[model samples]
Target: MAKVKHESRWYPLESGESVLDGLLRQGVSVPHSCRAGACQSCLMKAVGGAVPQAAQVGLKETLVAQGYFLACTCRPPEGTELEVAGAEALRVPARISSLSFLAPDVLRVRLVTDAPFDYRAGQYVSLVREDGLARSYSLASLPREDALELHVRVIPGGAMSGWLAAEAPLDQRVFLQGPAGSCFYVAGRPDQPLLLAGTGTGLAPLYGIVRDALEAGHTGPIWLFHGARTPAGLYLRDELRQLADRHPQLRYRPGVLAGGTRDIAEGPLDALIRAECPKPVGWRAWLCGDPQLVLSLRKKLFLAGLSLKDLHADSFLPSTPQVGASPAAAGAR
Candidate 1:
């Protein structure tokens, strides 16, 4: 049996069990998705073990050199010990510049990093408070916009959300880590049709991506679907409408759960999206928001002839006290 140590806990790895399986069997919660090793979400470093050779497959050379390995695919040889990668090495200083509501429950948060941070439009950064509580939020502002912007939907009773909405002091300082995830607009695909869909504050990342695509001079059709529970939840309505009107190739569609007298569709957003394009062949797609919604739409897009390589997603999982997916239960791919 391999002896695996994660944090302060130790587990006896059963024969043929991967490190992740062992950790999970011991009741350790590790944030992970696409456990097949493709997403790189369960990345952990080998502190004092012989990491399996296969664990480094497809990883960047720098990461490999730094002793990083995917816990999902690695099985330690007998007598190996390991630990979760330390996050302190990745955090940088940031300060909240402004906080204002986009809706009754959602706040538009703008922060300025102590140093310039370069990231793609659809990536997310994890914000850490002094108490060590942290949550990820997608960047809604573009790189050229000169600020780090996020749309934070205040969850009732949520620790981070409650403080930020009601109790946070002005110019509060925090630490940020990552411009992480794989969902963003890539350069040189100017003619490829792009599809962006999300529910609630999930629109945050999509909003940035739309502007990035337009700024890149993409000439193909760009479709956006922002889902909400009601008309009042449809934040940024006029702004998105004006944006669409200014760009002939952009189409903005807001979806509502309960039917109402508006230009938006009623029902689940994915159903409305399918009604818009029954066949999504050759189109690149990005999905954020609810985990079930992202997973469901991902499958539908694949069955509609979209390749997995062309579909990117970020499904927000509920945050644990020490770690989290995102503030609004949404993340960027």
Candidate 2:
């Protein structure tokens, strides 16, 4: 028998039962999704007692260093003490400024915080609605921008997406938690060729990161691959094309799955990247959008010569009870 602590309450952790399961059994509504640990929706911090190393697997170094572990995977020993993160450290109060359709299925949302909030371009934040349901969305706006921008794709039957698309009102106040993940571009790597790829709305973070790189005066060639199932699914196509035309160092390639359009490359997005840059030995890669695409491309790019250290990604898992399938408004991003 083990006493597991969350907040001020103590719950019994039966032997062989996971922390998430035990907590849920006690009616403790700790947010969680993908109970297998891939979504990071059940993240918890150890307040006292030793945290099992296995519980922190696949977490970012910064999170691991901060004593954060996934509750869904935590099979702790007896007497383990835990604490859910406080809202203050993880949440920022903000209000929605405006929402616009980027595509038939995608909406661009902007949020203005009460105070200055700092975050890298490629990081993501969890948007919590009035009902207490929350969903993760990548920030498409840069830190210097006046408002936080998120590109959301409507997913069929998704609660948060449906709410944002049909129910959320203007000037709505929402709590935003996080700017987490280490997939952003850093200044020191200016000389390294950057390869960015995404499917559907995955372009949100990739768009922000690309702008950040350009603003930092990156001298190396910068390539971006955006893929969609059809031309109508491609949001910001004209804008990205204009950006490419303006920056000689930047290259934008649009990939389409069904029809072979002259303006867009035909094939899977990962295949598009493979064809463009066969040897990515010294390149740094950023991938977002669908989880399968991100995972498969990560492996493929690594095998194609990109250093494992140089590759970064944010996989949007399908939205579940406590987990979000990133960019919940349209296509995978």
Candidate 3:
């Protein structure tokens, strides 16, 4: 079993135990959520031993070179030593700039930071409250936008979302960590057909990605689909429609599983998408939203001739917090 050294103390891991579990078993106060290694809240560093390559997956090369690894996924070799990273090193302070409702249950949050924060659109950041509660939200604003925008779907008992929607004061300072994820738009394929699909606030990243592509002067045919159970679940319809109208290369399709209207299609969203693009051989697709839906669409797109290399996905998992309820659960992948 590997031994984890943290703050001058050593903890022994049981057979097949992860570094996070080993420390938590010994009553260590490590911040973590979405134990599946998606949230990246339990990030740590290996100072005296080699970290497992799997634990470094999805992390930036700079962080990996600096010895950072996800504790939740770390299961080092026998006799390996590690260290817990300080929270201060991983968080940057930002202040809330504005808030508004985009839908009945979705809140649009804008934040600004004096710190030099650089991020690509469609990436995600973890918002950490004063009390140590953290939840990941994706960026809906472009990099050049004046403020960072996040579309938060308020869950009934979500601690982070509820606080942001009801209690958080404007100008309240909060810590922001990470701008991870590779779902952002990449320029250079100006003429490649693009397909983007998302559900709920999953549209947040897709929204940013669409604008980013257009800003980069992409002349490709871009098809964007946003799905919801009802029309109320869909927001920004007019704004997206106006955008599509201004850009002849763009098309916006909004649909509902029920309550079909003259403007909105009614059917299984995945089926609707597949019917529209029966042969996606030369298409570059970006899928975001519920894990199950993203998984389904990924498989379908792959089977329909879309290359896996051209398909990017960011799947948000519902957070099952041990401390407090979080909206949309954990990791806005």
Candidate 4:
């Protein structure tokens, strides 16, 4: 049997048991989500003993070099020692500045951090509650902005979204971790044609990226496509339209699967995009939204001539609605 040590405590791991399971079975509280390791909420650092390569799969090279591994996936050898990475060091304290409904199910949250929170537009952060419940949301505001903006979809029975929509008060303090993901605008690519697409609240990061590109004085044409199942799901229509009106180089297209108006494209989003840009060679693209949809579009766009290196994507899992549940456990969007 392998044994794991954390702080001053020792926990015995059952044969073939993972570090997370061993600690949890011994009544140790460790934050975790998506036990399968997708959420990265169960991140822990190995202080002693070699971490299994499998436990660090999908982690960034920097994190892996620093001995960080997903506790849920770490089945270390006998006598392994681990530590919960200092959560406070990674947390950026912020207070809710404002919240409003963008659509019936989407809440736009503005957070003002106590300290300068440096992050590129389109990166994501995990919002941690007082009880240690955390869920990841992308940044929809630029770094220069006074507040960080997040567009959260209020899923039925979603714990974090429900709190933000109904109970969280203005000035409520929350901690943020990360500014991770790699889908932001790069300033040097001023002349590269850009394609931005997403669905539902996935518009949040795309919105920020568009603004960032424009702010950087991008001279290339930017095509933005937003889709929803219905018109009601399409928030920020006027705002996006206004943005397009000001910038001749920017074109905004709104699509819907149902309830399409004369101004809105009526068809599948992927098909609409394919029809518009049949060959996206030499284009830079950013995609966000449902994992399946994003993955499918990525493949299609690559086959259509977009380079894999130039394509960036972020897939939002559905929100988990259970109180105190890990985002991965409930499916966090």
Candidate 5:
């Protein structure tokens, strides 16, 4: 049997077992941003063993040929050995390091682990509840933070949020996997105006991006616009405003998108953007939140004069983290 070893987290169980299998056997937690191949967060490279093809994971062709595998999918070929190398590539084994109510319904929790790793801002982590239900959460800290911060809006009956609110608390350990997904801030982006767009808790990663950009010494104009159904749903409005306080070049714009059709025209955030910068063809766009909102804004931005390449977005696909589905249901085009 093939032997699979993960370097980031300590492993137990016998060799040749699946990565998850080994993880569960040892009671060692790993973060997974996605169980399905659609999110690259669970990706692991096989240094030695042969792994079956997970054709749906969206891994680049070159990576697959080079023996990269998904811990959720591949198992080793007989007599082979594999290792999921690097704390950066693997998820930090952590518990709910801290939890606090950000709003009546929003909880900000941090997960701390005993490892060092790196990921671009805007990535996510998957928390596997006690009952094995998994939900993805965006990270809110810059790359160097020892603890990962997540902002979770407690859905009335969200399976995972329920666990967090009721049963889980400080120091309560759980299973998780992450540093997953390919959509995040691209370092080395040209210095230019940075457009930050978010809705709901999607602000998590955008916060991380802003922190990283400032630290990286980006002197370009930064614009942050958050559209909320109501002001209450905007979790960190004051925080963003506070950030703008110190950076004279940084601007924060908040709006209520659900007010009224007439209100939307009157508000005219997109139009205001065009008026300020007649041609924003080269500015970078970062958007996160409801897929519909992201889609609409993307279309509007492109129409207003932004190139598709200049736009980077993370569109949430509401899902239950179900175990299996037919080929068509797997989110492949």
Candidate 6:
């Protein structure tokens, strides 16, 4: 017999259970979405212990060489102690119950999975379409229910978005790999403040954070800074307003980037985030948006005194084509 300790509770088993299942049973929060390990959402560090090279984790050769293994596929080898944290990961899988237009160019997609999808507020999923097309989207679903909602921003020459907008069926079977990134709310650390920066379709994940905070009863001050090229670029404004109305702890500021004459306002995002929460000393931040915005905010927040560990983010992306889909874009420099 072997002892499996997780989340402070030990589950003694004749055979070790899958690493993720054991962790969840013990209440240890490890970021994961696509349990199949295709999304790399379950990336975790093994403090001490070794896994068989041919065993189930399906880790890449490079990652295995670095001692990186998948917790979703972990099986203990007698007397194994595990230590995992919320790092760069998130994901969830659900069906499109409905898709509506929030703006002419922005989409509001509602999804509900057959299984219970557990994810932090700021996490997101990769929406997959027929013909091997994929789109990265953040969950707008509130913590109040199991249904997942996502805000989608279509880009020109994108296959997934066009199919989702015009051809994808409501009941069609599409696969998703997520609750996949490190972007999310941290309620346990309520002693520190929280800053949420959103741009364009980025409101999807931010909305999730606000709902989770309200539900978890985090009393700390929350500053939300959202930016868009025009008011039209701001998806779910009405929903955000409703969220603000419901929670006194949440304060939201909407900024339009196009209206700028003063030298101070380089962009709407820069103005809103810098003006309100100028310092990130003890606060935790969740940022989701265009890659440029995500990268810039991470840099700026660090400069403002926030430790690298304190900042979490997910860079939004458009539909990626597989078979007739366009090639993957180059990694940002």
In angstroms, the error of model 6 at 180 is 1.2
Query: Where does candidate 5 clash, by residue pair?
Result: 30-176, 30-177, 31-176, 31-177, 31-178, 32-177, 32-178, 41-180, 41-181
Model 1 RMSD in angstroms = 4.7
lDDT of 2: 0.81
The whole-model C-alpha lDDT of candidate 1 against the native structure comes to 0.80
Task: Report the number of the highest-lDDT candidate.
Answer: 3
Q: How accurate is candidate 6 locally (lDDT)?
A: 0.64
Clashing pairs in 3: 318-329, 319-329, 319-330
Candidate 2 Cα outliers beyond 4 Å, as residue runs: 6-8, 33-41, 45-50, 54-69, 79-89, 322-333
Tens digit of per-residue lDDT, candidate 5, span 91-196: 4457778888876777888877666645677787666555444567778887788778888877665556766776686888765555665556566854788888
Write the residue-wise lDDT of candidate 6 on 1-333 in tens digits: 445443345555346576766665555555443444444545555544565443324444555565666665667677665443322322234578988998887777788876677666666666655433345567777656767787776554445566677887897766565555666676586656888887777777888887787778888888877777776666666777787788777887777767643322336587577877777797888887777888898999999998888888776643222223245321110
Q: Per-residue lDDT tens digits of candidate 3, residues 110-222?
A: 99988778999999888887766778889999989889999998876677787888999999998888988888888988999999999999899999999999999999899
TM-score of 3: 0.93
Each prediction's number of clashing residue pairs: 2, 8, 3, 3, 9, 13
Local distance difference test values of all predictions, in order: 0.80, 0.81, 0.85, 0.84, 0.65, 0.64
Candidate 4 least-lDDT 10 residues:
319-328
lDDT of 4 by residue, 103-172 (tens): 9998999999999998999988878887777777888999999999999988756777888888999999
| Model 1 per-residue lDDT tens digits across residues 75-131 | 877766666554456568888899999988888989988888988998887777876
In model 2, which range of ten residues has the least summed lDDT?
Answer: 324-333
Q: Which has the higher TM-score value, candidate number 4 or candidate number 6?
A: 4
Positional deviation of residue 25's Cα in model 6 after best superposition, in angstroms: 42
Model 2 Cα shift for residue 220 (angstroms): 1.3
* Clashing residue pairs, backbone N/CA/C < 3 A, model 4: 157-321, 158-321, 318-331
Cα-lDDT of candidate 4: 0.84
